[model samples]
Target: MPDRIFDFEKDFAGSLRCIPMAVRLKLDLVGIKLSLRQWSRLDRDQRGRLLEVPCGGAADRHTIGAMIEEWVTATGGTIDRIDPADSANWSNTNTVPEVVVLQAKGEDVSAPSLSQWRALTDQQRFALIKLTRPGHENKNFVPAMREFGLFLAD
Candidate 1:
């Protein structure tokens, strides 16, 4: 299984201080909300395992979800379960969500065309959606776009 952590996240991926986008995507897939405090409780090895595990099917999601809940609770942290259905936006290759477009425009980058959006991997789409949400730091938005080849030449 591939670890989908993005290149932009490499700065803190070693320490696992911040939750990498890959884990965030997995959390969405498994319907578990992992708090940063909870994530901090895990060592680098554990965080690495989370990145390495694949959540490709129903059984995989179940195993990861149970493992996440168990790990968080074992570390005296809580797991908030979210409905992954809300994450459907990333899976839709047809329409590029407005939020993602607007956020890109706000960054002085052009919105990705439908063809460009369709070309992205699900994890890339997930990262873009998460990076574009209101209140997200967004410092990495353009870099992620560039990495994904969704950014146009300036």
Candidate 2:
């Protein structure tokens, strides 16, 4: 695990408050999926180390899941399962966050499978969500997708 630092000021300033990679890592570590708006509610220190802790590429699904559980336990936040009833509402196009939706506009449009998405760490999923928005620069999108092991068939 390398010392991954997130520059909040440089990356998420003004209208584009992109979710920093560090915070993404923390969200993954915690296991419970979070919206960007939810992430915005966390305190500074909680946000800071999201990138500080080194989660190496060697991390597998089980290891990542366990780490996420541990992080949530230590942080005192309850992890809830996504309700089956709420499945239809999970990615409601009408209710999707503006920033996230913006990232998905105009690309090879195809939604990732639920199982595939679920298998990914929250950080990876978050990165994909952010990158796939409507108006985002395409250059960043492919790199982000590649880094997260997404769109293998393309």
- lDDT per model vs. reference: 0.83, 0.47
Worst 10 residues of 2 by lDDT: 82-91
lDDT by residue (1-154, candidate 1, tens digit) is 3456688778876467889888888888888888888898987788888988888788998998888888888888888978874567988988999989899889988888999999988888888898887776888889889999876557
Q: What is the per-residue lDDT of model 2 for residues 1-154, given as tens digits with 9 covering 90 to 100? A: 3333223224552222445654444444444575565445545554554545455443543454455456556666655543212222233433443443344444454345455555655445545554554554545655554444546635
Worst 10 residues of 1 by lDDT: 1-10
RMSD of each: 1.6, 10.3
Separate clash counts for every candidate: 0, 14
TM-scores, one per candidate: 0.92, 0.36
**lDDT leader:** 1
